[model samples]
Target: MSRVLVVDDEAGLRRALAINLSARGWDVTAAPDGATALEAAASTHPDVVLLDLGLPDLDGLDVIAGLRGWTDVPIIVLTARTSSADTVDALDAGADDYVTKPFAMDVLLARLRAAVRRGAAGEGGAPEVVEAGALRVDLARRTVTRHGEPVKLTPTEWHLLQVLVTRAGRLVTQTELLKEVWGPAYGRETNYLRVYVAQLRRKLEEAPAQPRHLITEPGMGYRFEL
Candidate 1:
């Protein structure tokens, strides 16, 4: 059974998630606050995390950062905050996906399954190393280096880069990238692509204004050229 950590301040939602997930053969661990969620994550080593941003003890971003410090466990933010800035912050902080409040259980479950699959896939069977210009992506180690120096990429950023680099010299459509990197629930959220791609270019490209490897193919998608 796949383990899931459900972190929410609302007791009712926590219970509901635990019961529903448990019914579906998931080993569910519940936490009512960020501190407990972090502790549970460390102890249980869940395959995916469902986190709420409005924690009474700590911000959900902090929890994400804490988990990213030591683990690559997929984090899905569950929050009432629907602002783009909040979404970007959570993703940049290391969340694998984000779901706003008032979500359909089915959609959430699908996303959860997708995250688990992605996590498993990331564990093996990818190119060990990909080089583009001065950037070196070590897929085996999940690390990126540019100009012989470590380049720190958020989990989301790294995932995006991985998708592009693995398909190097190919055009990956916005819909495909969204579904592959985020979840099936995503497609029209091209703004998310714009934001994250810009962030990646800033870190990986020689000039953010004129990116070399990460190229945007106007109105279609992005291509990573060698």
Candidate 2:
């Protein structure tokens, strides 16, 4: 069975998540604040972490940064703040995926399963090749080519691109990408997404300033048009 840590300041929520996850076959642990959540993250090493950004003590983003320094555990952030900036900030910080308040448990659980399964598999770990339009991605080689010419990509940038390409045409949430790519410690670094996305555009797109293939969803995350 997989271990899951649910971190939120609300006691009721913690209990609900613990009970619900337990019922679903996860070995669940709950924490009430960011500090304890970090401690539990290190100690419990949950396969996936469901994080709440509105902690009573430390800022969730800062905690996420701290966790990113050490571990690559999968992190899924929960927030009541629906601002694009909030989502972006959390994603940049290292969160794998983000969920808004008033979320449906069924949807959340589906997302949880996706995160767990993807995390365990490790995004971009495939040694297979992916071909999209003029783009050529060698998963085994971890290389990108356009129009038969090789393109250089940083480790992080390639990982980000892999996330977008794998979910081509789908609106992959900022949280899911962050958690899957950066790990569990980054549940609040949303700004990081813009930076890396910009990097990807610069490298992959013919016109970085006005991208055609990499499209943005206004207040949501980006998508690689297939």
Candidate 3:
């Protein structure tokens, strides 16, 4: 049985999730606030975490960051925050998936399973290193270096770069990138692509205004050239 930690400020929702997940044979632990959530995660060592952004004690993004400092366990955000910025923020903080409020239980379960699968894949079977210009990306270590210096990237930014670098010189459509890096629910969120692409350019390119490696094909997609 897979262990899951459900973190939400709403007492009733926490109880409901616990009952439903228990019925499905998952070992469930629920927390009413971010601090408790973090504590439970450390003690229980769950396979996955269902986190709410609107916690009473601490924001969920911080919780995600905290967990990421120690673990890569899949984290799925469950919140009513529907704005693209919120979604991007959670992804950048290290959430593996996002589910809006009033989501279907079946859909959440499917996403949970997908998150687990991706987590497993992340552990094995990916190119070990990719080089583009002065930037060198170590996929297994999840680190980037430029001219022998470390280049810091948020979780979302790293995921975006990973997709493009793995498909170097190939046109990765905006829709495909949004779905693969963010989630299927974000296929239409082109603004996210724009923002993250700009961020990546500023970090990885010789000039942010005229990017060399991360190229945007007008109205279509992006391509990475090495």
Candidate 4:
């Protein structure tokens, strides 16, 4: 049985989710605000979190950060915010997936299952270090160094880099990168790829204008050449 923490302020929706998830054999815990959500997360230690961005007490992004400060548990944002900026902000804050409100219960369940699977698989068996030129990424420690100095990256940037570096010397299609980093809800968000890739180049490449490691594939995709 997988434990899931569902955070939302709506009484009806919260009760409905608890009932639905429990009926589906999930050990469900519900929180009506960000503070209780954080407390539930710490005490219950759920396998995945379904968080609403519009909490009564604290912004959902802060809750995401709070959980991230101590755990690597998968977080899936459920919100009414439909803008691309909101999507990017949630992902950058360490959310594993984002599902807009008024969503189908089945689709949400599928995403929940996927998040649980990814979390389980991420527990072990990844290369500890990946090196390219002056860049060194410690996958195990989730840290990066360039020219023997730390390279700061947002959660989304690191996720994008990890997806590419783990498959070094190959072109990662924009759709694939978006889905892998942002979640299955993303595919055609090519601008996301462009922005984060540029950020990675600025930090990892000797010259961001003339990059050696991160290469664009025009209409195809991008590649990380070791």
On TM-score, the leading prediction is 2
Task: Give the TM-score (vs. native) of candidate 1.
Answer: 0.61
Give the winner by TM-score: 1 or 2.
2
Q: On residues 135-175, what C-alpha lDDT tens digit does candidate 2 reach at each position?
A: 88887678889999999888889888888876554456666
C-alpha TM-score for every candidate? 0.61, 0.66, 0.60, 0.61
lDDT per residue, candidate 3, 1-226, as tens digits?
A: 8889999999999999999989998899999999899999999998899999998889888999999999999888898975656766676567766778999999888877766665666677556898877899998899999998999999999999999877565456777799899998888899999999999999988889998899986655787877
Clashes of each: 0, 28, 0, 0
- What is the overall TM-score of model 4 with all chains considered together? 0.61
Give each model's whole-structure lDDT.
Answer: 0.86, 0.81, 0.85, 0.86
lDDT per residue, candidate 4, 58-103, as tens digits?
A: 9988999999999999888898985656655676677866778899
| Residue runs of model 1 more than 4 Å from their true location after superposition | 125-226
Against the true structure, candidate 3 reaches a TM-score of 0.60
Off by over 4 Å in 4: 127-226
For candidate 1, the C-alpha RMSD (Å) to the true structure equals: 11.6
User: Candidate 4 clashing pairs?
Assistant: none
Candidate 3 regions with alpha-carbon error over 4 angstroms: 125-226
Error of 3 at 212 (Å): 29
Consecutive 10-residue window with the lowest summed lDDT within model 4: 166-175
